[model samples]
Target: YAASKGAAQGLAAGIQAGKGVAIKSLEKLGVKYFWTGMSSEILKMNHYKEVANLTDVIYTAKLKVCDELTYDNFVNMCEQFDIKIGVYTEEVKNALLPKYAVPNALNRIVSEAETTAKEVFEAESTRIAAEITEQQTAVINATYSSWQIAITASVIAIVVIVLIMVIIYLILRYRRKKKMKKKLQYIKLLEE
Candidate 1:
């Protein structure tokens, strides 16, 4: 259970970090320029709001329960954010930026966001798997050591029992021989 929670937290951290990176990329590509630009009043209000709301969405999503469903939901949110960001970029580019630079810039922003997400997912999942494997290996080694100790103890116990049995047999045989010798001496005395 602890491991599961840890995994969830790790995933959430990765996703949140990825979201921050994506947002930075958007900012670097002049996303905020469109927001505060002089012609911004003419633009569809929802486009900017959607882009702005992304930070809130990501922040809230990260705080949710860390589970598979939560992770899936995050991925879906990222995809949606990607789409919304694309639309916003397109709207801004057509309204403000020159044609020659629009396509590559737009594509780059979206692709960077997607690539960041994929990288985060891969890196975090791999780290988690490695952690689990390391833990499992430790457990296995501990169990193997316990088995070795148990076997060693059993062997020592068996050896001690065998030694005690041998000692008892030797004592019994000596006592029986002594008794026989005494009987013979008595018989010899009777004969005399």
Candidate 2:
């Protein structure tokens, strides 16, 4: 039994050693392929650079004939050369004035005018609102004054009516007493 156990331990150790060796070999193979791929990419970049240099030389040679071209010929030549026209840098863009300077100036003026008109509209609206408030206050004051006048008139009318009624009652009482005294004197003479 001890011999079999020792053989099993040795087999396990041999398997671990084989695995380490396989892993190291795979690592080395990966590194070799990585460098090979990098070299190929570098060679491709060099070839592209050579091609670009050749194209630049051809383009320079074609530009020599530009000064001899007429209007239609120049347009054809530019088209054939794939020439693009524009400011390609900030310095050139800043140095050259815009072609639409007048239109841009007019646009700015129009924008300012719009802003001023908006401000004026807001001011007019505020003024109109103030006027409306003033008119409302005036209307309320006029209504209150008219109500006061009407109430005063009503109280005066009631007082004048009460005084007239009191005067009429006193006159009626005086006339009734005078008639009763004359009747009493006539009765006494008849009895004698």
Candidate 3:
């Protein structure tokens, strides 16, 4: 898009009455561009706001409960304001994690870090498991489809054979990986 604009500058409309961008489209995507001739100085002042805006969206600690929020809510949070989700998630007084008994401030930080780490690990595990399950189902469905091809007449026999061969290759590749992971790589190595 940038290259197209640069090379076709003559075809481009100047920033004027009908040539300027409409706020509606920009608002829909939640985009903001504060372009200035002195970009370096402009960024020096606005960069902190940009970081705060991003951090507010990613972190729940800045949120509050029952605070009607939309896109700009993120910008508000980054400037050290309270966020709605912060109130919701903070309602749980206390529970397990025996290390929470420590009275030191550093211990509290460690506890929070451990909690965040556990959440991250669980999320990753769930994502990977879901991906594996989806791929496994696809492979199984493809194999089933290939098996159905066996009923076709000799005219379609070659295509069915190719389909079956492909299915067999996929199944063997999956099994080979499992074998390497479980039995072969540990001690014994075997050939196909």
TM for candidate 3 is 0.27
Instruction: Give the number of the best model, judged by lDDT.
Output: 1
Model 1 C-alpha lDDT versus the unseen true structure: 0.54
Q: What is the Cα-based lDDT of residue 69 in candidate 3?
A: 43
**Candidate closer to the true structure by lDDT (higher is better), 2 or 3:** 2
Considering TM-score, where higher is better, how would the candidates rank from best to worst?
Answer: 1, 2, 3
Residue lDDT tens for model 1, 1-117: 436755675666555554555456655543443333322321332222233334433323322322334457655543343344343343333332223233434445546645665
lDDT of 2 by residue, 121-178 (tens): 4555555556666777899999999999999999999999999998988888888888
lDDT of 3 at 146: 82
In order, how many clashes per candidate? 0, 0, 5
lDDT of 3: 0.38
Candidate 1 Cα deviation (angstroms), residue 42: 23
Q: Rate residue 179 of model 3 by lDDT.
A: 83
> Which segments of candidate 1 are over 4 A away from where they belong?
1-14, 30-106
Query: What pairs collide in candidate 2?
Result: none
Model 2 ranges with Cα > 4 A deviation: 1-97, 132-151, 174-192
